[model samples]
Target chain A: MIDLSTFLKEMISLPGLSGYESPVREPIARTWQPLVDELSVSKLGSLHGLRRANVKGDHHSVLIATHMDAIGLMVAGLDDGLLRVMSIGGLDLRILVGQMVTVHGKRELPGILQMIPDRLQDKSKAGSPPGITDLFIDTGLPINEVSDLVKLGDLVSFATPPQEMSGGALAGHSLDNRASVAALTLCLEEIRKFNLAWDVWAVATTQEEETLVGARTSAYEIKPDIAVVVDVTFAKGPGVTDYHTFAAGKGPTIGVGSNMHPALGKYFKTLADEMDLPYAMEYMPKSSGTDAMAIQVSEEGIPCAVLGIPLRYMHTPLEMVVLKDIQRTGRLLARFITQLETDTMEKIFGERKA
Target chain B: MKELIQKLCEISGPSGYENNIREAIKKEVTPYADSIEVDPLGNLMVRKGKKTEGGLRILISAHMDEIGVIVTHVEKTGFVRFGNLGAAFPWYLPASRVLFLNGTRGVINSEPREDNTKVSTIDQSYIDVGASSPEDCPVKIGDVGVFERPFMDMGTRVASKAMDNRSSCAVLIETLRQLKKSPHELVFLFSVQEEVGIRGAVTASYAIDPDLGIAVDVTSVGDTPSAKQMEVGLGKGAAIKIRDSGMLCDPRVVRWMRETAEKASIPHQMEILRQGSTDAYVIQTSRSGVPTGAISIPCRYVHSPSEVVDVKDLESSVQLLLKLIGGPVQLK
Candidate 1:
């Protein structure tokens, strides 16, 4: 069994921005090595761990893709020792000031992402939100030393430590996806003891934030008959009480939209109901904003579904996810995998006998 | 072509919910395409000339989705808070009449601004569905509504919602109908979720991996009243794109398209769109890479419900595509 709390903190503590995922991929590869039968890396740097089915006859495969990349900043230029930065993903500039970060340069340096004081700017422009050019990372070192230590294009990840909140919620940066990765990890651990009818491919896709490159290529390479993508959705919190956001600590969400296959979605709902697990139905209507977007259209087409973990404060430094939700998502994935039969394709494609 | 444009633009299909528009396009191109498949992402992949062996693969793409609003909250008194499905501005949203997918009507309005310190984002806006209470209203949370605009025939100019790509869609459908026989294999893709990002094109491009990719979409025009300085204009025939915010057209493809338009006696102009991009951006970078260019139909007031495009410009775009893809042409 995996300790969810320790694994989550260790994963988020590493610096793996969208295009740069090695720091986080190394730890995940180590943990998933013993659980999977074969492991390989894609040309785009996505980590794939395949577990062949124990069944004797012809078998298809099901892929469970969880993006391991986290949103962070890249060094754009040097501004008088203060590093100018650009967002690597969808970042709201409003929440970036005064946050703690770890700058990966010559050596790791603890720094604070800061903005010029409000009083220093012109009065008319003061009320307006500061643009990316106005924000810089202050490392508290002298100009010459800062220039020598940090170079251009260095990755800067949020350094907020994981905090255990009341009622078993884990709060930290990168929980938007690392939490989903943890859930997939838990699913892999649970399925190791079972005899599945289909082969299982657990992929940690990369660059899902900037582009769907990793997921698109990996899905094309694997050519799985079915794919279920696990990603994070907005959780209900302060200023986030809308139908678009789900209730945090409730359960995982099953996606419904053009991107999600109806049969695959129905299976997840049916499984959750049979197991008496709490889950919500998220209507994507179009893009699920997950790896399923790419996986669904790989090659000819693949029946794709999405399982989303409700996460609060997505794309921010202090994201939060309920620990119980992660466990429930993992259990749901395991149960769904066990239920797949050789005729599952017929069932999913609506060829089932009446 | 006008009837097809009006038929497509009148349907209500936002970024993620492209079912209505997809069905309409499927019915229009069913007779022309050799085979048609709706990808899992809701992109209608229609192919022609599949019998040609070892032919150069060409992909022509146009997005079917338009910008709209998704219901975020339904208040007890029937006031609904909404969020944008794609790129939307609060300045253009006030007092716009919208219709939901389920046939419910609403009017978007905003709270009175006492000061300008805060940005007037979508959060400050709500949709009034004219119900005494939430129970009396048919709208629910997560329901999407598109601007309810009727297609208009402004003499030579046509105007409607979603003309940004529906205009291009009409061009694609017309091209399919007009092309005689092409030695090169052709794939026409009506991509989805393009309003949110250039999302549907990424997978569609990877699936096809065509030798040449051309996205057909609308481009901003400089002919409008006090419009931002752009070289493109309405009634300028087909706009051969050179640069945009998201992509730089491959020089070889650009040269080929320009030569084809000139030699075919099609009225054409060059486009350097300042801000937005089309599906060609993502398709150009797929796999190793595919030489990509875009044929833009010049339009005014893009992303608004009342976008305008010249009918002659639409016809020219269709003719240009037919000339380029009617036979195999060398990329080198």
Candidate 2:
């Protein structure tokens, strides 16, 4: 069995930015290899780990999706020697000024994000954060040497290593869905203690942050009767305290939104309540911004429910999550999967007898 | 007030993504407000003061939303092409840091041009988080990013991004914290989506349907070098709105504000803003037409990343509100 903290740290260290999830996918596939019966990779680079059901009748599969991509930057051009970059996900420019990054050029090069000095910039804009143009990657190597190593369209990722904070909190980049990925792994491990009836397709989806391509396509191919999307949500911390963000370490968030089926969400909420696990229902008025959005609309439509692990400083290099929440989320999901009956599909989306 | 403003300014709540800001305001005002409720569109409407029978009902509004950028496309090379969510100036965006609600941080930069011509539009610019390829980028198309500058206490003045309305929210929060009693029913509205199209204020004002509406928002000043010739100036007290680019202030509402400021001896200046409007404009047109006016905070660099506001002006705006609504609305 893999240690949760060690697994999460290794996941964060991998460079699996959207569309480019191969680097991270390799380890995920390896981790899922022993637990799943059949393993396959999607055309768009999504990883599929299938746990077959033991039932004698027709098989019903449940797709569990957690996006594996991390937000990062791409080299747009090289000016003099420094790389001109662009955002791959939602980048907070304020945190970019002094952030350390790794430029994946011909070879991995260590660099510091160099913001144009306040003295050289206009007074009106001085001390004000500069745009990406006014910023460049300083590799410390000579200009010609830097030019030789870096190329246009190279990838740059936050190089901040994972930190184990006080309490049971873990902080690092790519925790958004990677933490959820860890949760899915724990769910698979939990299922080993029970004989489940429904097939479980643990999918490490691609491009959820950039596009729902991985979820949309994977769901269509697998055609699961139900889908449970696990992802990280905002945790109450400095500067973020609203209904949209839940408290970290308290519990996971069950999503209620356009993408979530009412019955499906209610079941998860009831399950959490039944087990005395801490959970909150996040209201998504429109798009849930998860793989469930894609899975819900796939083909004839599948009932989807989103489960979120509370994360602090999401998307930044220092995104933090409580290991307890990940374990709790995994336990709840495992219990829910084991409780699924043959008529569970009818319970989720069948017509009522009025 | 400074601490409150700083706290509010740091929260990232772009249009359609105001839950974080809404939560901050809700927590602060929960103890003082009579009842607090969030509308379907994510508007935090707080009812305060005393409920008087047939007495005046005044609504004080401040938008909680800020200008942002929505990722439109992510290039194969991992550069994210984006569209402006509100009125984020292209020139100001270059070298500015933007953050997604999830904390994905990236800097906005224009694509290099061989001709050395600066990229003037949003399309020519992209967000850089240093991903090497499309697969390497963590951002997806349609993810929203807002300015992520920190609050700075510049002695007498404070500077920060999203202060355009977060500062106003601080004013409303402070007003709620200070006001002990009121003769009229006061509905303090912390609205959303103001930066995009004043969407939240419109829906919120329609629901309240108050007799009078007053919006507290930051207004631009011509205080900088060779700036446009505008009457509003930073540190010159609150700018009492006469009219702006959005709506003409109700003459009666304007008169009411002016006399109240004078009687209370609150420092204020008459403002004839030639551009931009506030939540007041939308509220003024809600229901059977509300007599709406705005108390403008004279701010330099209205929508830029580093918005400057005089702390004195923030205090005066709070005093003026406390004087006007701490008692009955006497608009005769």
Candidate 3:
């Protein structure tokens, strides 16, 4: 049996941010190379792994996608040894100040995002954080030495490592997505033994944090019959109400609504119930702003579904995830792939589906 | 080009109701069309390219609809209330001239307020359509009204109502009119209800699943005062859209259009609109597969009754489309 937690830890330790994803991409390709029947990648850096079945045309060609990119910052400008930074993705300015980060400049250097204090009185003003212009990174070196190591547009990432807490929870950066990639890798490990009859595609998508470009290009290139996206959803936490967030410590979330195919969503729910696995029915009510959004509209619409692992502090440096929830998501996806068939695909959607 | 665009901007077509502009486009396209068809949803499909061998189904789309208001109720004293169709900023609607779909002109009046008084809203404002009383009203509930149509020539810049997209539709018609023999079978689709929610392209894409699609729309220009600092601007020529907030356009199609413009030496610029969307959202992922891109006429004050654009840009768009279609079918 593969240790899924170990794989997730390895993935979360690396910092492959929005545009600079080659670090995570190379290691992921190495792990997925031997698991699929065919390997193809998009110019935008989407890695797809396929495994065809022993029986001919018995399985419906299906694509399971998980994005591997994380959100970070770039050195917009430099002042003294402290570099002024701009976030590449959405950043909650409240937690950004005083956070330690790894500066991927000409060479890797350690830095910290800090702010200058003004003698303003109101706490309201303090609570309302300043723009990127107000944030800067302190590189312990002198101005001349720092200038030699760091240049403009150099990527900077949070310096938190994957830490396992006592309550089956793992904390680190990029768990919003990298953990999903780890779950995908575990699914590939189980799928090698199953003699299912269908073309199974496992894609480690890129740049999902910034835009839907990777999924957009990959969906066009592969043009699969059905698509299932795996990503993270915000979980219940302190000061959190039901309106803004869902319950944490729950199992994976099964999305149902207009954009997601209703049948495919119901299929996953039924499968989870039959297996007695923990799951929840969440309604996106519209096109989900994940990889599923790009996949559903590709090539006359694909019957797509999203399975989410409950995560905490999404889009932050130290996001939280349950270790067992990862295993559950892996097993459920592997089961879906092993059971994929052409008749099932046609039945879920009308015969118009290719 | 300036005169033609001026004529097009003077027309009006709001979402879910575009008959007046539909009939006007029919007149323009009828002369050049071997056949033309208008669906029940009010989308006009004009077919040209009198060739038989290409087997190509290419859709050239430009939305005919613009932002406007729908009369929700009529209060006493002939004060008509309304709701906006698209992103008409609440602050930009106080004193603008509005016209009903049936050619009834009115003024959007905000009630006078003291410094201590609250500002009025869409629900509070009234359309003075010169009606004597509620019983004498010609424009009632459910009637659509827009900024009164006007085409003004300010030196080289032309400003008119519904130019957000009507400029593109006119260019499509002009391109079809100027074609000798298009190698690819062209479907000049005057899509409807784009401002509401891209309602027409959703069905049109199903009807004509093309090998390739090009959405002719308007992209934001950075040269405007206090505008977001993007590179593309008015009078620079055709603007090739790379990506917008709503869609990630095909990279191959983006490269193809850029190269086409460069090869023909047509002055053009690249656009990355941080906000809003275009018909390209449906064109890229419509049927089976379609490589999609957009050529925009850089226009200012979009969504307002009077959107200002350059006639030079319109001519540049026509030349670029002509070179792309009739010249040589090149694929990257």
Candidate 4:
């Protein structure tokens, strides 16, 4: 089996911004190749790995979609020896100052996201945090060399390497979703030991950060009987202990909301309880802000459930997650799939009807 | 039609918690619909006409959700701190009444501030549900509620909370009730969660994959005192939307709606709303892409407790929709 921490570290190291996911897709496909029966890429660039059912006589399938895309910056314009950038996803501008980044130009060059000094900034804006237009990616090259190597529309990703923290936690950029991808990968690996009765599609979706295009198209194509969208949720951390945030290093969260199918959410909660797994019931009263949002409404609508791994400092380069949460999420998914019979739909719908 | 609009407007269905309104709408459309089903996202889809060879699939959508609030925290004193479910403005919340889905009522008020200070944000306000202590509180986290206001009839106009959308729902329902026959297949969709992000229509359109789509909703009017400049106003007939912030109506669909209204001699006006959008925004981009437009009822004070729409506009909207969907919809 592949190591979860190492796989996640490798994923976060790559540059796979929304709509540009080939770099991360390669490693995911390589890892999932030997674990499933078939592997294919959707036209919209989502990685789909199908682990066929061991039981015969036409069974249902479940799509486990985890977005592999990461939030990053793109070169929107070129300044004198510096690059003007625009964010590809939701980024907190306050956290971008002094952050290390890799400018994916003609050659991979290291850069730093730097804000203009207060002395040189507009008088009224001096005390305020700089906006995207006020920031620049400064590579240590001359203007001629910088212009030669970098072009407009080049992608820039966080260069922060994954760091192991106290209590078996890991920190890095793109862990918002890469952690979920590692969990789904762990589920795929663990399910190999079970004689599964339903086909399991482990899909590494793209463009979840910007558009849900990847999950939307993949769900329409796969049309799974049920979809389990695994993604990261906010972990309770410094000054951020709110109702929406869960604790890290505990267990995964089973989402309960409009985006989630109530019966499927209950099934996961029941399974977690039976297995003595610690979990939280996260309430996402509106949109779950996951692939489940799109998948739930795809092509006549598929019953959807969302599993969340709590990570701190979400969408930042130093986002952190406890490794145990990933493992627990993976274990829960494996157990659920292994326990799914051919009549699991009936059981779920029965619960719904009741 | 007025009674149906009043009934729908009074129901307590926020963006995500739309079960009550969905049930209410199902009861209204069941007798007229050939097949009625609710999608996973709580969108009520009713199939009225059958599909024939080469017949166009037309999806007529009216969102059932209204902008409201979700309880995020219950204070120690039993006051509820909440978040906006859609676009619940903090300015509109002060001194307003809210009713939770569980039948708990509360009055929204801001913390005491010196005179001339303003409550410009939601965090500065809380809902007093009359629970003196946390233990006595009836509303908990994740509970949703909408503005509690009675629907009012003002001769040619109606005023109520959720009139922004329930008025449109009434129009769609009336269109379904009065239409005798049509060559094209019609799917009347009462979508959920449109105020949040036009979410319900995205999936419903993909499922229906209609050749043409039209959304009937309320649009802001400029006739209000010092309102934002717009070409739409109450009592001006059905507003054939040309563009909004989210989507520009397809020329073909726009032309079809305008031409149909002209031929039927239905009162109509061209609308160019600079702010806000409708379900047609997402429906136009569903799947391989659908040519979509919106028929907006001119509304005053939208997203407030007292949204007013002229009854003449609602009737005209229903008539226009009937004429558009009444025959074979040829886009060419």
Candidate 5:
């Protein structure tokens, strides 16, 4: 049995916000290095780990991607020792306020996320809402020293550490995806013990929050015959009515829609149902908003699918994820990749049997 | 070269639905091809060499599709309500021209009665198919529509609709024409439905069982005014893919293309597209393993009513591909 929470805690301790993801990059890459065959970085900063299956003619290449990058802020301009910032990826302003952050300056400095009071919020003046200009981070440093140390484009990340809750749940800063990365790490570890066919490339994709660029470049590096993107999706809660049928504490979610290949979607759903693992379905009409969108269209186009862990308060400092979901998802991917051979895999999109 | 480019541009092959364009491309390449076949999904694969030899099996794919719209609903007042087949900026929709797959023409008109703010919101726009009633509408749901042809010469830049990828299709065509006897087992797969999801390449690459695949397509150029400060430039030459939002070209293959271009003195640049993906990504990872790369013809205003490209760049891409095909297939 894998101690998933322990690994999640270590991952959450690292502040890897989007473009400034150096802190978590090398550590996570090193974690999975012994389990994988070849580990390298693409032209982009995506960390790719390859594990070749022992079977001969198991020449199939499969990529399982989970972006290591997370949403946070970049120091655009310093104002009076306070950091004026830009959101590197999608930052829900509603959740960002009153959160703790770490300002990555010449050195890592602790900071608090704050905004002007509601009087300045101007609720009536709607449409596009307030820009990042309205929000500022206070690091408690002198203006002269702050300006000298922190220049524009300094990365800022949430300062939250991963913690286990009573009901098999974990809360952290980047549970939106780092939890998925942890799951991929578990998959890497488990596959090492088994003698499987096919080459599995476990990728900790970068820049997925900013853009799906990391998966794009990394997919090219792995050049897998089949690709699977693991990420997180919306978990329903109060005030979040416009969402999918996914719930927190569920095992995992399999994407099914136009963007998702029907065969791959059905295949995952069937496996989840047969294995008796709790799973839900989500519609990915155009783009899954995961690395799947990037991986699905790699050279000659990789037949792609997505496996997501339901997450609540996504893109927030206190992003929440369930523990069992990670373990189950990783197991499912390990089994799927191990079972893959050229013959059985070619039936990926072929007609179903009676 | 000019005639080939003109013919490729004139043909329409919208994403997810490409039949006529594949037929047209098949007729053109059939003479030089050893065996020609179109898959069930409509991907046209033209093979020129034998599978007997242990020579490299390479798939040179060019998407025969362009971005367009599908008629989702037809209003009672003879207007067609539609949605985009791929990513489309509404700024390019209103007052622009479109053509249906069945040769029926339509004009995209903004809802004049509504506020200008909602013009691009899909509901505030409809296609005018020159019909007075819903019964008179020639098109129906599932029918694909693409931008109407608009070819022009603006100084050195040639402007046209669907140049987003048709320019590269022309490049692929010219490159094949230049190679009378390919040195390797070549699969010239004129892929269908690329503007949508690169649907054609997915099927074609599987059938060819290619050891290496190269997607010839269009990339973004920064030479345009206020463009995203891209290192790639128009007329500078063809672009060897290093990294893009799709797939990264095999480093050894990229080095080979660059070396081939530089040694032959064919002007070429390396592209680093951040937000967009290409067919190379799908081809690169197909089946078990196949080394894949892309050579893109840089174009301006991708997926818009009017796209622009430099003919000099198109010729350079063709020339570089010619060098690759004419010589031995080498993989590092």
Candidate 6:
């Protein structure tokens, strides 16, 4: 049996910003090697693990993609021994002040991300949130040592360790995506015992935080008959209890919008109901802001669906998720894969009965 | 053509919810198309002409989506709070009527400030659906609504809610019906979600991988009072686009469109829109890059409920498109 909590904690501890995921990919490849039959990497460095169909001459394939990149900061310039940084992805800069970070420079250096004092700031900009120009990373070292250790264009990642909270929750940085990676891992492990009719491609895509390059390129290479993109969604937290958010501990969400195929979404909802799993229908009127957006449009166009794990404090260092929701999402994916028949495309396309 | 424009503009399809409109358009083009397929992103691709041995693959596109509002919250007083799907300006929203896909109706209004100031943001506005409370309210969170104005045939100019692109859609439909024979392969794409972004064209063009591309859509004109400085006006025939904010028209494609218009003696004008773009921007940048240009119908008050377009301009656009795509297109 796979321990979900331990796997997630180990994955989140690694530093893998967008477009640079080797640090995290090495361990993920090792964990997924035993669960899959054939493993390869895409040209853009997306990990593709294929488990061929057990009982079929020629079978269709389904790509289950989960982005493994996280948002962080990069050194833009050196400002008098302090590192002036730029954000790699969408980040709420308001919560970035006074946070711990590990600057990946010539050597691993511990630093604190801080904003200049209001007294030192310009008179016109005081009492407002600091912009990227106003923020810096201090390593508590002398100017010569700091300048020698850190170079421009180095990566800086959040150093907050994953913490286990009461009620089966985990909080840390990179939980926006690493949690979904864990869920995909669980699905791969669970589907090992099933005799599936369709080939399964578990893709740990890269660059979803900044550009969807990984999802876009991988889908073109795989050319699967269908795809399901897994990612995290907003959870109900302090000051965020709208319909767009779901309860963290309750279940995952099945996306319903233009990005998702309606028949595929209904099929997931039916399986979830049969398995007695609680889930929400997330309505994304435009972009789902997930890997599905790119995967759905690749090549001749593959029918795609999005599965979301409810998370709290997205893009923050202390983002949180319920461990139970990850397991539920994993089980739902396993059930769907096992239940797919050779003629499942007809049902997915709403052409004829299976 | 005016009736088709009204028919297409009246259907309710915001950026993401394009099912009804897609079905309606598919019905109109089913007889003329050789093959039709709806891509995963809801882009309807219709192939009209057959491919010969060395024929060029051409894609002409027009987006089928419009700007609207999506409900974000339903208050206890039966009023709903919403967000814009595609540039639903707050100043154009108040006192406007809207219709949801499920036949629900509502009127948009803003909260009065204590200091009696004007509401300048969407957060200050709400929609009243004639319900006394949330229990009786037919509107739910995530329901999308578009402007609920009937189409008006104002002499030579037509006014409607979604005339920004539906006028172009009508132009494409007429072009498909009129073109007799062609040596090159033609793909007429009725794309989705162009209002949110040029999303549908990005995927559809990648799938089609055309040799050359043309986008038919509406453009802002200087005919309105004190409008931004522009040379194109309402009745200025077909506007051959040179540049927009999103893309610079492929120079070769621009020259070809202008030369084709002049050779045919179509009432044409050169257009250089300072803002906004069309599907040609993405189709030009599709896989390995395709040389692309656009034919824009001049309109006024774009993105507003009652966008106005001249019938003469629509006819000229259809004529230029037929002449351009009805024969072999050689970029060299």
DockQ of each: 0.04, 0.01, 0.07, 0.03, 0.04, 0.02
- Per-residue lDDT for A1-354 in model 4, tens only? 698888989998888987678899999999999999999987557899999999878889999999999999877566788897767778988889999999999999999999788898879998898787778999999999998998655788999998999999999999989999999999989989888899999999977886676788788889899999999999997786578799998899999999999999999999999999999999999999998988998887899999999989988888999999999999999999999998899898885532
Backbone clash numbers for all candidates listed: 2, 43, 2, 0, 14, 0
Candidate 5, residue B118: CA error in Å?
5.8
TM-score winner among the candidates? 3
Looking at candidate 1, what is the lDDT of residue B250?
63
| Segments in model 4 whose C-alpha atoms lie over 4 Å from true places | A351-354, B1-332
Candidate 1 on A102-194: residue-level lDDT in tens? 998899999899888998987887867778767889999999999899865567899998898999998999997999999999999999999
lDDT per residue as tens, model 2, A279-348: 9889998978888987898867888999999998877778889999999999999989999877777776
The TM-score values for the models, in the order shown, are 0.56, 0.53, 0.76, 0.56, 0.59, 0.55
- Candidate 6 wrongly placed segments (more than 4 Å): A352-354, B1-332
For model 3, the superposed segments whose C-alpha errors exceed 4 Å read A1-33, A38-50, A53-127, A130-174, A197-228, A235-238, A241-306, A317-325, A336-354, B30-35, B48-57, B114-119, B177-183, B228-230, B326-332
Better of 5 and 6 by lDDT: 6
Query: Model 4 chain A — which ten-residue stretch has the worst lDDT?
Result: A345-354
In order, the Cα lDDT scores of the candidates are 0.87, 0.85, 0.80, 0.87, 0.78, 0.88
What DockQ does candidate 6 have relative to the true complex?
0.02
Question: Model 4 in CAPRI terms: which quality?
Answer: incorrect
TM-score (second chain) of model 3: 0.93
TM value for model 4: 0.56
Residue-level lDDT tens digits of model 4 in B38-156: 88888899998886666788999999999998899998888899988888877788899999888899999987777646655898889999998878999999988899988899999
lDDT of 3 at B110: 71
Residue-level lDDT for A88 in candidate 6: 73
Q: What is the lDDT of candidate 1?
A: 0.87
Task: Rate residue A215 of model 3 by lDDT.
Answer: 80
TM-score quality measure for candidate 3:
0.76
Candidate 4, A133: how far from true, in Å? 1.1
